[model samples]
Target: MSGGYDLNLFASPPDCNFLCSVCHGVLKRPVRLPCSHIFCKKCILRWLARQKTCPCCRKEVKRKKMVHVNKLRRTIGRLEVKCKNAEAGCSVTCPLAHRRGHQDSCPFELMACPHEGCTARVLRGALAEHRQHCPHGAQERCPLGCGATLGPVERARHNCYRELREAWSWRQERSRTLVLGLLRRMREVHRTANLVRRQLAQLGGFLEEEDAMLVGAPQGEAEATPEGSMGAEM
Candidate 1:
């Protein structure tokens, strides 16, 4: 991916066979050509794309003629290597395959601040402590949830009373909204109940009229009592 692995990454000098002639670095993902010559897969691919020939022997090459050297790649993976951040005070050494993992979590590796607007690069291990003093980190909201952004100096001068008051005001407004919603839902439920009661009253009147007709009685005698029905209000 990088022409080839940097020579400085290896614990010791790599074998000449493991070196790519094009990049002059340790072979990564080694590939063999029909000319019986080996080079880094990336290096050989780029060479063939331009010249359609092997760089080492100047022999014609076809894209389909390239063969992967899995055995060599495995051997290279097993080779000892130092962390890429070794120069940044990391002293870890492991197999080449493990080098990437180690670098990923290396405490000595330089990292940009997660806080926005920060351009400083600090060691990964020191990032937490750096954030405590970083200017951009001052954007953190007030601990009381007052939504106030304050720097170190501003935080020292912040009024606890004001923060608490703001929190209280927000809670009061939220409670009012919740109460209003509940009242509206209750009113809708009451309205539905009232409509159902009115339908039952109409059905009762229809049954009374049918009963009176069957018995040959006066409609007034069989009429339903208005007081028997419930009111709309709860």
Candidate 2:
């Protein structure tokens, strides 16, 4: 980046009419005095505030009538300018009017250090170096959903928190497995209870039928026994 920062050499020199006589820079907000000599709007205004005379011709004027030169304003706006951070790895060039907007988007521009309590604004290309020494730069979040966060050099502190999280996770998984096993046993018990109730109902129906057959038999046949037959034979 340091090798390619000469933007002025690439751009054509601005015309004399497009330059500000006071600042010697390209015309910015040009204002045409009644004398027909043009100067930057800000330059002429600042000069008139002190004394009512044109900077170029020293012409005295009472009204100090100023008109905006739209044609020249547009011409200056089209002039090209290189990024101010061209030495910081930026190679972008845009119109002069867009310089401010382009500079904001340039990758080489400075950004505030991300570390807590640090307020250093380093260029993007140099941010790595700044972060290397920043206290909070290497911090990482706990992957096990713990609220704790720790940095690389602070590994000893993180180990205590990591072991607790792992232990809690294992206990939760074991409890879940136990609950599933209990549910399966409960389902088997419910099925066995249903089978027992059905078998009891069938046995009760068979017992009732045998009891009815004995009650409906004649009294003589029920009273006859094998003992009467054995005594008659003797």
TM-score of each: 0.61, 0.51
Q: Residues 1-234, candidate 2, lDDT per residue (tens digit)?
A: 121113262256766667677766666677788888877777777778898887888888444488889898887778777778867767887887788898776768999987767789988777878878776667756545565676766644567656887999999999999999999999999999999999999999999999988877766565775677878999
Q: Quick one: best lDDT, which candidate?
A: 1
Candidate 1: lDDT of 13? 90
List runs of model 2 lying over 4 Å from the truth: 1-10, 62-64, 125-133, 138-234
Q: After superposition, how far is residue 192 of candidate 1 from its true place, in Å?
A: 17
Tens digit of lDDT per residue, candidate 1, span 138-214?
77667666677877778778986786889899999999999999999999999999999999999999999998787
Which candidate has the highest TM-score of all? 1
Question: C-alpha displacement of 202 in model 2, angstroms?
Answer: 54
For model 2, what is the error of residue 47's alpha carbon versus the real structure, in angstroms, after optimal superposition?
Answer: 1.0
Off by over 4 Å in 1: 141-234
